[model samples]
Target: MLAVAAGCGGGGTGADHSTMNRRDGSASPGAAGHNDADVMFAQMMIPHHRQAIAMTDLVLSRASSERVRSIATQIAGAQNPEIRTMSGWLRSWGEKVPAAGAKAGGMDMADGMMSDADLAKLKAARGERFDALFARMMIAHHDGAIAMARDEQSDGRDPDAKRLAGQIVRSQTAEVRTLRGIAGGR
Candidate 1:
């Protein structure tokens, strides 16, 4: 359920909205003076972060790289609170949080969510290999999140949601760079 009524504080970088995004991946009239984009952003990002947290948990249980664990710690710290913030948006919006019933969909819309199998593999890996896998998987996941945030910035109308989306883009983009550095031993 997307809370449609919450206001936002200033956060993150601004988005580039040269075009509008619709669920169909085509341009629309930009939520047409509604907070649909905020709802959508919250709804989509929840599941995305959930998967990320799950992946982080996997590495933390078995990782040998202090750097990898540290990165995972940071990612979890940033995203977990974001989930709460978005949940607040849904509550304030008076929208039902997604999947209030099975009829409602979940955050399946986020970019590169890991599967149980991927998690299993990570659990089975060791040492630098675990770090490598975590970095690679997280990079993909962040890229997906970046795409979704871009969409929200372009098509979302709520000022706060747009602001959050921009923040997500900047923060996750920097994280992606950091992960790449980890991958390259920088």
Candidate 2:
């Protein structure tokens, strides 16, 4: 019994402790849950969504048009939950969520994000000008999201991840049209 207990102790040889299955039922070490596609999608997307939300918040604070503010609120609201959902996926997969400041630093659509200068410019504008800028910038941001979503849809193997990407594409495409109309350019 002592030998058995000792064997089960610090240097246990029954099984590899390093490759144990997690409580969340992700997978054993030898198995893959999501994949690099899922990891890349989530990692790249979180900050992209964050930037969109930041833009939306800027307009929500000083937007003159009820329509624009309403749209900004909606965009922020929808994307916030999606960010949490994607983060949850990363957590379940035992992956790290990328920081907002982390450079996506890749050839992906996330690289097309707005510069700090652009955000500063947005923060400085107001009234019809602000509406115009917000519409134009958000249109571009939505386009970037659509591009990323399309990539995920094409490459992602996970069913839920692909479905969410499709949702982002459809919803953001519609929003692009709506924002363009609001910008008086449609």
Candidate 3:
């Protein structure tokens, strides 16, 4: 069983329109209110989601199990839109949007992201080995995301950002359970 490290951060599903309007009576994405936590959440989650997408893509071509493929597909479906949503929020906030292909390393890997070497091993796996590896890795990945989302819920100031954090918590928590089952609770 691969042990996932803890970390301290999802989606456009939650839009708190009540807080979206500025005092000037104009609408803005993150203009309603945000703090450094919100900024950090967006910055960190983008690459995390990208790596998850990459992991799912790797399984798509190699895994023979229907369950694994389905889970991978669902992950990509949910996260691809989320990546765009976070990117948009960063743009609205005048923050630097991380490049899509950028690999997380060193301090950036604090989010429980798989290292490049881990990804390489996952990419090199095949058949049942691939499915088991994918399950273990994704479970850890989802746990890290859940931790970050919980933090965002507690510390973030933006309504939209907090809402998205809650969504990630709920959705990814469930996904983690599913992945755990696939991994035989490893």
Over 68-165, each residue of candidate 3 has an lDDT whose tens digit, in order, gives 98889988888887776766666766678888687543324456688878889999999988888999999888888888888888877666667778
- Stretches > 4 Å off in candidate 3: 1-32, 105-110
Candidate 3, clashing residue pairs? 9-148, 9-149
Winner of 1 and 2 under TM-score: 2
- Native-structure RMSD, model 3: 7.2
**Candidate 1 C-alpha lDDT tens digits along 56-116:** 8877667877888888998888887777766665665555555422211333324566666
A best-first ranking of the candidates according to their lDDT comes to 3, 2, 1
For TM-score, the strongest prediction is: 3
Q: What is the C-alpha RMSD of each candidate to the true structure, in Å?
A: 9.2, 12.3, 7.2
Which candidate has the highest lDDT of all? 3
TM-score of each: 0.74, 0.78, 0.82
Q: Which 10 successive residues of model 3 have the least lDDT summed?
A: 1-10
Candidate 2 residue-wise lDDT, 8-49, digit = tens: 001112222222223343545654235556567777778788
- Please give the lDDT score for candidate 2: 0.67
Rank candidates, TM-score, best first. Answer: 3, 2, 1
Q: Least accurate stretch of 10 residues (summed lDDT) in model 2? A: 1-10
lDDT of 3 at 45: 82
